[model samples]
Target: MKVWFALILCWQLLAPAFANEAVPLADDPVVEQRLITIAEELRCLVCQNESLAGSRAELANDLRREVRSLITAGKSDAEIKEFLVSRYGDFVLYKPPVKPSTWLLWFGPLLLLLGAVWLLIRTIRQTQNNANTEVLDDTKRARAQALLQNTDLPK
Candidate 1:
């Protein structure tokens, strides 16, 4: 039992180190760091809301390898990004370029927010108008009161 407890504790302690290990990049620390930074700024096409560097998907791993190769080949960051953009289009970038092709992607949320606000305002106004229309006038209120007072007509 003591040996099993010790093994469990040891595994628990070492588990985090294994968890944090990413796909291996180039041996050069500088190039590896740059590659990681670039990869972290790219979205993984196979995973929603996960950066390429953070995603464990096979496609993300392939993209990381591609980035490492580009860095090893002495490609500047901009050149590497341009190459990726040319091949994959703007969707791979976490921060896609502001261009005609991407205007909807860039501005869609704001437009949706504005449209929702407009709809909410219109709904509220319509609800208020409906409430006003449904309210009983003075004559109707008096008639209702008379009906209540004449309750002897029905059980």
Candidate 2:
């Protein structure tokens, strides 16, 4: 128990050494604010599902640094975005413009949903029609009656 207590004390003493330092804030708060705003509107190229502002990837950090430099250089938000887009293409933007090339991306899910709904309706109608047109011939009806009347059958 004494050895355990000594180890625990040592662990507590060394815990601060293992801790990570806080990230230094940008010199200009306005530039940081603009970086966040623009980054949130942009997708992280390395993490396709994550926004640039939310991603912790190395590429995300580098992109943030690049954006900060652009802000320092007095480029407008639009110009900064245009520059990134020119380098990385429309995939960098969270909301890419609807153009001829992006028509499939914009409308694919909606088209698939409509097609599925139409198929479901058609299948249901076909099933209903099949059920309605099913004939109960004498032999089949007698067999059904016999099954129904069998006392040995479970309820």
Candidate 3:
């Protein structure tokens, strides 16, 4: 009975050894490689700022699996990307292609920066011009002198 109890304890300890290991992604490493390559080009919809290949989000996993199947079915990388783009729109592309609709997206910041720089230069030039043209007329100068001379504030 003591031997049986010891054997049962041993069996319990060894049971985890029988637990299934994580299955290899697929039967083909090439498929996994292609999946990673394609996924790297996609943005994770749920993660917003993360790439599908690097994100741990559930949606990212689903997209990876979808890519894997597309690869396995012999779709070229470009075709796989097009498929995703068709389904998810340009937002799924980390670097969206230039189009009439997206021209502002690509160049708007540069235009805004140029505008800000021009405004700053104009403001600085205006301030310097105002400072340089500080000739007070005689009457205004006399009034300024009178105010400076009268240091007492009204009670």
TM-score of each: 0.72, 0.78, 0.71
Per-residue lDDT, model 3, residue 20, is 55
lDDT of 3: 0.87
Ranked candidates, highest lDDT first: 2, 1, 3
Weakest ten-residue segment in model 3 by summed lDDT: 146-155
lDDT of predicted model 1: 0.88
Candidate that would win on lDDT = 2
Q: How much does each candidate deviate from the true structure in C-alpha RMSD?
A: 5.6, 4.2, 9.0
Per-residue alpha-carbon lDDT of candidate 3 for residues 1-155, written as tens digits (9 for 90 to 100):
99999999999999999975543496898888778777788999998899998998778877888888888898999999999999999999989999997899899999999999999999999999999999998877777777899954332
In angstroms, give how far residue 55 of model 2 lies from its true place: 1.2
TM-score: model 3 vs. ground truth: 0.71
Which sequence of candidate numbers ranks them by TM-score, best first? 2, 1, 3
Which sections of candidate 2 miss by over 4 Å? Answer: 1-23, 142-155
Candidate 1 local lDDT, 1-155, one digit each (tens)? 99999999999999998774656657899988998899888999899599988899988888889999999998999999999989988898999989999999999999999999999999999999998889787877877887989753322
Candidate 2, residue 112: lDDT: 100
Q: Which of 2 and 3 is the better model by lDDT?
A: 2
Least well predicted 10-residue stretch by lDDT in candidate 2: 146-155
